[model samples]
Target: MKKLTSLLLAFCLTLASFAQQAFEVMTKKPTPGSTIVIEYMPRNTVLQGKKDFEATAYLLEGGLPRAVEVPLKQEGGIFRGSVKTADSTRAVFFAFAKDEIRDNNNDEGYYTALYDKKGEEVPGAHAALASAFGNFGGIWGLKRNQQKGAELNKKEFANTASQKKFATEYASYLSQSKDAADQDALRKLLTERLKNEKISEADLTQTRFFYQNALKDKAMADSVAALLKSRYPAAAQQTELVAQWNKAKTLPEREEVYQKFAAVSSPANELAKNRLEFFDQVIAGMYADSGNYEAAKKYLARIENKQARANALNSIAWKLSGEGINKQPKDAKAGLDFSKQSLALVDEEKKAMKNKPAYLTAKQYQRNLDNTHNMYADTYATLLYHKGDYEQAYAVEKAAVEGFKRKDASMNEAFTALTEKTKGAKAAQAELEKFMEEGKYTPAMKEQLQRLYIANGGTQAQWTSYISNLEEAAYNKFKAELAKQMINVPAPQFALKDLDGKEVSLASLKGKIVVVDFWATWCGPCRASFPGMQTAVNKYKNNPDVAFLFIDTWENDSNRVQKVTDFVAQNKYSFHVLYDDAKSKEGNDFVVVENFKVEGIPTKFVIDRNNNIRFKAVGFDGTADELATELTAMIDMVNAEGGDVKKGF
Candidate 1:
């Protein structure tokens, strides 16, 4: 009776006990250090001495392997060894398995048939090699997030009579066996050949030539021709390429043709109209070269269909805004109009056509709309500056900069979170430090970080750091001068109707100890800390000397007012709930959030009867309980300082 063996799936490692030869990469620590120990079963099968196995490990980067060969020792069906690396970065390891070598001693371990656990014949050395080569190529590409070489895929691997014989013999050996052992061996062999530079150039050229010359199909011919021009232009036969391209008929057939021409020139050149979107790209490129953005807008405006016009206008606007052309004002306004029009067109198309083509076009137009809108923002800021509206200009520029910083921070935080999730805390911290030190942070990084921070309960302190570190000193200087009016100062005074539609004023609460809380219904953490704040509100509500202004700093509208009113009613914890139209006022003017520098939700500020800020706190940081306790103690201290209790309820 055959013994039963259970199979288990382990993410990083697996241990199997079987008659089959098994490879084990043993890590000494619970979490591996830089040095990984490689173990191969049936150690007696390997040759003796430190250098016997002739194994090599690969440190893959950018789809290419940096090989590190390790000396080995055989210890009964298990080969024991270690490969050293510079740092604690986690690595996937592979080692070369070779047959008998031409040793100095001339002693040999004769090649024998390898087998799987089921006792089936493994393919011969050469055959095993070809398959391994293919596997290695695929894995290398995969690690780099790229595709394997197109030339390699199309070309014949073995062409010279000698090499052909070897491949044929190997293929024959592979065919004779059906076991996974044979397949594995073949895969391993091919991987070795891929690393050998000698094999690369020879195999690549032979394969490329075979695919180009032997495969007479127009599509294949054209692809090969284009690939050759791009990859090996000096060796390419332009005449043959031209002939193949001319014969193309179908769309896939035209892929090779387009690539061929694209290799010679840009996609915007004449005779290249593959994608409809490329039309706007071409027009933009042309207009950009001539430095006539107004002319470009004129061209864009001529498009009869709104979608097309939107696309053209969007492209032109993006180019002008990015390049900071002097004539962008006219182009930007037109682009803004076009984007709005395109949005309308997409809505109309969704309702009327509802076809895939129209929908896709609409989507493209919509993307252009967003791109143009982004450009419009920058252009509008510039226009404001030219118009001597320094404050408005600064506001827009600061918003743009903050947007970039937030995006960067969000990306950084994401990478940090992912690393922590996958590799544990130490590795994650190391990755984080690497990012910060290496200047990997970008505008996108800022945006991503801000989004992530918002998601994971961020604070004003984090935002402050984010703003300061947005760019280099010059950029920092420019940003700092602008932020002087916005940062950590007395906020501009503004008033609006409360949830009851009654007039509310900052001046009205002047004489009392005012704790103005700027909040929104959509803010998650804000809602969370409300109960704690309500406790504070209840403690002082009856005291006419104290005023708790629960101001909702969002747009003043019926929907907003209703949401706040409903929240207040459900909770039955009402202070003075008010609304703020942020659209009309800069963030620096909001009493609860902006004036008090409240970064995250549920921010609270304690104002003395003299209307001076006595205490301020940011996030609830699992410290909401602590904050409440502290606030109570502080209130007692304030009362001891002769703070009057005007009215007791």
Candidate 2:
């Protein structure tokens, strides 16, 4: 009886141990060139209650990390997946995700080391895992620890040869180190290796970039470049040819440079091939600019990549159609020709695509094709509308709107206009009303609808009441969707100097609703988002409890402050621009962005009165009014909420 009780207890303990783990590795003692099977039970973690999950295995082989997505299959309550490793794989790290929510095993991640023939762990397995965790972990939703990663790198790459072999990774490690002495030691080691070792051209190029960009040592970088040029003259000449081509102003000069470049550039070089294609597009644009549509078409024909060719044609067409540029009848005619050509190219490409790429599923591929076709169709239709051919424009635009189900605001506005011309104002008004109710209509669409309503003998009071009802319904719908995306996280404390050198800190605005925007002068998307941000700022400027901080970060120019000031002045923006000049423990600039764990620029955070981040917006893809409306909704929600919200991770 005693033996039986002990056996039962042991069995229960074993089962409990298995249940405690979020994931289990089915493959025992995984080695190089082997398959690893894993079972994930998402009873806990962020992926809890989620039906679909994907496992991404990060395999480090030959000093490079490769991410392989393993499709998970549901088996009872758990998900099962497997991945194959290469013979040179040192380690395999796993991260699980269901859409945006990720399970990174509490940010430590789940991983296994590959073993050698004798069943011992590989020498640099931990080093590979460390690099994967620190460098590329954020891409898979795992938090990065640069200091810890640097320690592991220093421990593994003790010898100069190993450091030279993995020069890029080694340099990244050194840059992360806080200790100046450690950097000096590694720099000396690499200097000695450069003198003694017969390094490859690739390594030399990486080393040169590290010295120039990372270390800010122009002299050392120039010396390395000289060595690379002397060792590989063809590569050096190709680089020079590209530089000359960029500088060339006249068509004949550019043609001469292109001939020289083509002679030295190898077909096997992907970068060179891409550059050649880009040159062809630029030459085509130049011809289009000079109003030589025939010559432009001939130049565009030289581009081998069909998608690139189509995009080039669309860009030229857009430029000529007087969308943003000055309008001319001749330009509009040429634009119509280019737009037709672009749409035809899209159709041909769709017919030729027999199979989707391995990365995208069949549904995703079809959706992509539909989107591309619709976009080109809209361009064609828009050009026709500019040409005053309303009947033909309506025919092309209908395929994009009705056939492909395109819900874009601009596209729908154009469709409504065409509808008014073809199907009468009543039909257009009904269509606009449906779109407004669905919360898919833009401010421009709203104005057009109002004009039609007034022209159709509707009273001003009736129009106002009708629009107000639609807006309220739309706002409620938008709020419900935004509620699902609401999250509560502690806002990282920061103090930055405003443009006038006054210090503004988050602590100072404790009871106020704060909107923090991270931006830079050089980022195109960041600049594009500012107009909407300004709208939001202007809306809340009168509110004493609201504050907007436009923090400038990640600027590489020496005169970044002056440039930022000049930009604001020229744009006539009334923004409270702040400088993100704080340094990390490693002495790296732009600490605020790092502390916030922001992956990209134009990210905004809405902090509640309690100093908790209630909302985080990553990018702007809509109109200025849309952004303002979204921001207002977030602020109102945060303001209305009571009690301390629990942190969401």
Off by over 4 Å in 2: 1-25, 29-167, 179-185, 233-264, 323-333, 340-369, 387-407, 424-426, 455-457, 582-588, 642-649
Query: Candidate 2, residues 318-366: lDDT per residue as tens digits?
Result: 7787652113434778888888888787777677775455334344456
Task: Give per-residue CA lDDT, model 1, range 221-247, as digits (tens).
Answer: 455456545555533543344466557
- TM-scores for every candidate against the unseen true structure: 0.24, 0.79
CA error at residue 412 for candidate 2, angstroms: 2.7
Where in model 1 is the C-alpha error above 4 Å? Answer: 1-492, 555-558, 584-592, 595-597, 623-625, 639-649
Residue 326 local lDDT, model 2:
16
Best by TM-score: 2
lDDT of 1: 0.45
Best candidate, lDDT-wise? 2
lDDT of 2 at 257: 87
